[model samples]
Target: MTTDFGLKETGYIAPSFAEILDGVEDDYRTRLGDDIALTSNAYLGIFARLMSDASYDLIQQQEQIYYSGFYSTAVNSALDRLAGNISLTRKVDAPSHAEVVITTEGEYLIQAGEKFETEDGLVFDLTEDVITSKQSDGAFQGTGNVECEETGEFTNVPANTITLFANPDEDFISVTNPRPAGGGQDYEDDETFRKRLIMENAARPGPTEPGIKSALMNLNGVKQVGFIDNDKYKTDEYGNPECSVHIYVLGGNDDEIAKTLIDKCAAGITLAGSIVKEAPDATGKLKEVKFDHAQQHNIYVKIDVSINDDWNSDAGVDDIKQAICDEINSLEMGQRVNFTRLYSVTYDVNGVDDATIAIGSTKDKLADQNISIGRSEFAHCDPGDVEVDLIGL
Candidate 1:
């Protein structure tokens, strides 16, 4: 419930710089306009009131019971450790309509390398070391834009950018040199040295920086280090499409781990978890795995699908069924096939069970076998998109 505002020292407060002037002078009060004054004073008192009001409205709208959008670093760090690779894809599978998909994230470790071109061709070697550096002022923690002037023993120039010397000992340049933007610098002064120290010691968080809510979700102990935010895409109707943030790790085939995460993500929600296995025969086909629906106490399974729109009868229901069924039937046993559920409710209508045709095994048989389909009701449904939760229980 509390937002952590990173404070380096005990003296840190809300910096009542605004309150300091409250009764000090009416002369300077001209600077505070209606909105600014209201916001500044409100921040000291009724900001919590505003939050309570917004939270109550959010709860009423069914956005979330408790706000779960913000995440913590513990979760992010956990995911970072678990993901060892960084692989991305536009299409995870033919049926997967995810806007962006991350096949793996933390599974691969990246290191510094050099790429050089010669008459023979291009050569790349990972032996080289790559480091990131920044410049700051010793007087304060913040470092504004700095200027550099080289003279006499130094390579003096006018309007030249600063450079950080990779090998300062070889040149007279010490770590004190002020590098221009994206340039390396060498410095000799203690002040500059202190600046370098601060820059070096500062945490260098990639992508989702430290102190920010991590988009990553921890699955078991492994962290799903990568996430895709799909709320920005505008659809054909010139409106943003409904979207979700998918968290995933980027290495190894831990079917058990992946399944566990999917289940957690689908909890108390219509979004179900589906486990996918790598198919040996094709590049995109991943075998759908049926897992135990423990909550429903049934044996769930893969089912065939056929889309029918009498309005689009030009593309008739029988034709759609024949085409889809024929493709499914054409698959060799044990081969990766496009697996879908037969009796899933459409995503367009919330709590409305528009039962579609289902085939394979009966619900009673599936229950006898200890597998069951996930809850079919949904919220904030998107039309025509039959999003089914697949997970290996």
Candidate 2:
């Protein structure tokens, strides 16, 4: 196909700044006479320079316009527009949810907007109103649905972390979440969206493995997804049933996840998991669905750094820890964590002269080697677990 705007077989081509300026000067010389001097500060020379700049800008805009039509090169709204043509939209940010325990002295009503908080100031609000009855221990206990005031990472905390109510109530005594608040999601960024769009292009979107995973990933708050299909006539070594597809999802709404699994699965493909739930089908018929939560494996790291005067001992330690956590947490399920990769993150911080790193599953047994993760397990590192030993030079 013949393409305008310098489109070549290889890719889009645009004239360089020097070429544009030279062309303008050449045209002026050719049209007017050779005797006319085109000095640096001359009006003609200045006018030619401005014209070249304007022309170059126009060409760049044309380049952006051409690339916007393609997925690999588009950005922001342009990428969204292209993906929409294929029936895929970007996932929006989702709030983190947790099962909270409301503890009160007597019969009390917990309103939906009422909030519970951690000592660090992370807050969670109740999702619904509930009336608690007095328990045998003399404290009234009730309710479970509470979501983080914000979304994305750090929202999923450990058990019993939430202990305070946002606004004190005479009827409300204390609050604590027995389970961590999870399913917090951030809006899908352009790069992640581009990757999903490319993968979805490879297959049709229903009853297939890729389709099932893509659908689940699109759900709010879902972090990582692992797919295992035991197609043989007998039970697999992993204990999965014959002719079944077992999914390990890290985070997401239970009901939405169950429904997606039921909808995308082919008939006779048994969904394998210990957890079971009732999900309504498209026609509003109740159907039983099953799936498993991905097992989370903690990775511990110890870093010994030799640094100069520029390193702030207090803040640099936290910076190094956060860098390591982000790098390891970005790995997919079953991906091996390379010990050498940790050193790269440490050196990325300023004032680092030397770094030695080791990693392991248990805090006691750390070694400088690759840690292999299992198929159903997601590897993670906490900033606290990262021990930074700074040696002053």
Candidate 3:
């Protein structure tokens, strides 16, 4: 048992071996006479120490067992069990899916289950069959849906990566993806799952702004979410109609985004976004849902730093660029990029004493001033776009 007094809801302090040993020795003196040799080196005192060590271990184990019942302190199997109470399951290795366009020189008929492959050998299967419509210029093209053959992050391919057809058809001139594939994910770890689980207890995705944001953040592949509400009598400055909710989302499946809007928002409240999808409600009636897909605001960084000749400029340059990009991308939508932050991220690289940094939304407008990002824009940076010039001693 713990010597410190406390409530069970807060936490308990377990007694140490020294404390337990003193308690055991005091009890022995009360029963036996004080004339007994109870020094730590003696046989009787050593026996008491062994008993104290055993009691200490048991009490610590008891404390852990008690704490494990709560979701906040639980791990692995216990965390999974607690999530079940709120109807939330941990996200496992789910397959990615994409949209593909199949082209042909002549009238081509594509069937469902047709397999397409990437250069790395990631396979994708067509969800439905489509027949190409002949254009006036003599080319035929048709659009179809595809899902990855494997379930993991590796299955997520880039634009035009799916060039080769698993079963080659001479009639098909080419197959390609217009946009990069998404939604493939690995097994969710404990920390990410725990955050989502905690949100479930707080917001629970009801007819509220916070609830909607919380629900979207919990979705896989979602990076940032921004919300704006218009309750005026007329159209708002952002062009949202009166009594509308406008959400700008950077990532997540379009269908899932639409479905979430349908489920969480209040009935009769107008939703605003660029993309619209028809989803079913509790009564199985089709409802049109809308949400805007946030556009990427590419950020270009230019750095002039004087460093020691001993520092490896080649490797350290890349590290500086990555650090700047990581810090910027970590920010959610509508967050400001302060001017002073550039110095902090650049200095994080070793052997860099002084630096002058300039940033801009476009490469042509690079300046020392900070740029304010709008609610519907996400800050992005490419390694190629980052410019670092070092003056070595």
Tell me each candidate's RMSD, in Å, in order.
Answer: 26.7, 3.7, 4.6
Sort by lDDT, best first.
2, 3, 1
Which candidate achieves the best lDDT against the true structure? 2
Residue-level lDDT of model 1, residues 145-256, one tens digit each, is 2212221111221112222322222212221212111111222233322322232234221223220112111211111133334454333132223343333332112343
Q: Which pairs clash in the backbone of model 2?
A: none
Q: Model 3 has how many clashing residue pairs? A: 1
| Deviation from native of the Cα of residue 149 in model 1, angstroms | 44
Off by over 4 Å in 3: 1-10, 14-63, 66-72, 117-122, 134-139, 150-167, 178-180, 233-237, 304-319, 345-355, 382-393
lDDT of each: 0.26, 0.83, 0.81
Off by over 4 Å in 2: 1-5, 33-36, 101-109, 131-141, 167-178, 232-237, 306-319, 347-353, 390-392
lDDT of 3 by residue, 1-393 (tens): 224522365586677778878788877777887877778899988888888888888888877776677878887877898889887888787787778988986777799999999989899999999799887767798988898989876676767998889998778889998766766777888887888889777888788887888788666556567988898978999999888888987666667777888888887888887677899888899899888867778889889988865566569988888888888877778777765797998888887888999988888889998878888887777777789988663
After TM-score superposition, the amount by which residue 142's alpha carbon in candidate 2 deviates from its true location, in angstroms, is 3.9
For every model shown, what is its TM-score relative to the native structure?
0.15, 0.85, 0.76
Judge candidate 2 against the unseen true structure and give its global Cα lDDT, from 0 to 1: 0.83
User: Which residues of candidate 1, in runs, are more than 4 Å off?
Assistant: 1-311, 314-393
Looking at candidate 2, the ten consecutive residues that score lowest on lDDT are: 1-10
**Residues 238-320, model 2: lDDT tens digits:** 89988887888888877678888878878767888876878877789988878877888899999999998788867888899
Tell how far residue 246 is off in model 3, in angstroms. 2.8
